[model samples]
Target chain A: SAVISQKPSRDICQRGTSLTIQCQVDSQVTMMFWYRQQPGQSLTLIATANQGSEATYESGFVIDKFPISRPNLTFSTLTVSNMSPEDSSIYLCSVSQRADPTGELFFGEGSRLTVL
Target chain B: QQQVKQSPQSLIVQKGGISIINCAYENTAFDYFPWYQQFPGKGPALLIAIRPDVSEKKEGRFTISFNKSAKQFSLHIMDSQPGDSATYFCAAAPSGGYNKLIFGAGTRLAVHP
Candidate 1:
């Protein structure tokens, strides 16, 4: 198991503003992923942040809207750009251990953003 | 072909009763199945998981039944309690690329005491 810490647990921002959420892991991990959870919905994979490469984004998400930065194996950041009312959601940070073959994930508490 | 469909969008169960949630996947490449539980104002936590190689996996009060031929799986919560009232999500992923998970629409469970 891993312990992940996220900054700005809850924030209220005006439309058109941008916010950067930070994720810090207790130990190094092989894979780091970001997820989004809308109100009363399931978790959606936004992107997979690579240590030194560009993040791999999923369908319906782009780097322009959500820029990711993974400086090292234990730290990463996600910037929600040009926010709108629809951007209000809980952003989560998760990680998978290198030794685990089953790929069990450990999640953070999540940063809740409310775009007004 | 990458979708995981879940049933019973919401459920109400009495304490000490069984709470069952079912899920089906369309992709045969998906060999890893996991269940997540989320409480209000909290992130989703991995509850239990099962692989297609086994028919069922049990962990304490939670059990997972897998049917590879049917492309289906289900979660059983025995002696459900009020503390278990939360949103549950089912996810599927391929063997090597385990981080790329396709999550199903969550099920909201209410275990009343």
Candidate 2:
């Protein structure tokens, strides 16, 4: 298992404000992903943040609304832009140590956000 | 479109009983199936996983039964304990790609002592 840490475990922000959640892993990894869990919903892949490429957004997610940064193998950040009440959810960061074909994900303690 | 569907949105079990959660997927391209356990306010942790080649895989008290033809898989927890009470999620990933997982709705399990 990998040790993952996220900043500001929980936060409350007003509508139209943006919040950035940071994730750090003890070991270096190739693929870092950001997922969002809406209230009472399952986790949804927001984007895939690779070391040296643009993050790939999922179907319903866009980079403009949910931008992701993978500065290095061990660190990544997810920014929720132009937030609204519906944007309030738990943001999780996960990493895969092995190659893409066969790898398991290890997640961090999610960042819980509450929008007013 | 929901890729993976989970059943019994929630479950209750007695200590020492077996707790079972089932999930089904639509895409045959998904070859890897993994189950995750999550406590309140915490990120999901990988419990166990299986590939299409195997019918079943077990790790300690946790077991995953996969059915290739049926496109379904299930998790069975033997001797369920109070400590095992949490939300369980079943996810599937494509065989080759970035390995993005499509998660199930999740099942909240409660074990009575």
Candidate 3:
């Protein structure tokens, strides 16, 4: 089991501004993932933040828009750059422990961003 | 290309009745299946999980039934209560790699007292 905390639980930002959401894990995790949940939608994979090197982004997502940084095993940050009204959604951080074959993800409280 | 597909965008069940949500996946490589429950303003929490090697796994009122051949799985909430009213999401992950998850659209369940 792992505990995760996300900062700026809810934020209201103006369009064209950027917001960085931080995720802190209680224990060292092998993988950290960033996800986006639009209004009344499912979770969409934004990227996989590795301890080193660049993140692995899914289709339709790029590093320019969602820049991820995994400085260590227990912390990661995701920046939603050049935000728009369309970017108004909940940003979630999830982590998976090492040697966990089930790949169960423990998530943070999530950062709810409202773009006006 | 939604890797994971969930059914019944919303469900309403009476108290003491059973609430079931179904999900299917197209990726044969996916071996780990997990269901998450979310309240109105909280993050999704893992309710139950099952691997392809097993047919079913249950924890208290939450049960996960897996059908590897059909590439499908379902979550059964027995003896539902009003507190069970929330959104449920079914997610799938490949065996290895970075363990990135692909999520379904989610099912909103309302258990009336």
Residue B21 lDDT (model 3): 98
Candidate with the greatest TM-score versus the true structure: 1
In the order shown, the candidates' DockQ scores are 0.66, 0.69, 0.61
Minimum summed lDDT over a 10-residue window in model 2 chain B is located at B93-102
Best-fitting candidate, scored by DockQ: 2
Identify the candidate with maximal lDDT: 1
lDDT of 2 at A53: 76
What TM-score does structure 3 among the candidates reach? 0.93
lDDT digits (tens) for residues A1-116 of candidate 1? 89999999999999999999999999999899999998888889999999899999999999999999999999999999999999999999999987554678888999999999
User: Where does model 2 exceed 4 Å of error?
Assistant: none
Per-residue lDDT for B1-113 in model 1, tens only? Answer: 98899989999999999999999999999999999999998878999988899999999999999999999999999999999999999999998877777899999999999
Would you estimate the TM-scores of all the predictions? 0.97, 0.96, 0.93
Model 3 has an lDDT value of 0.90
Task: List candidate 1 segments past 4 Å from native.
Answer: A99-101
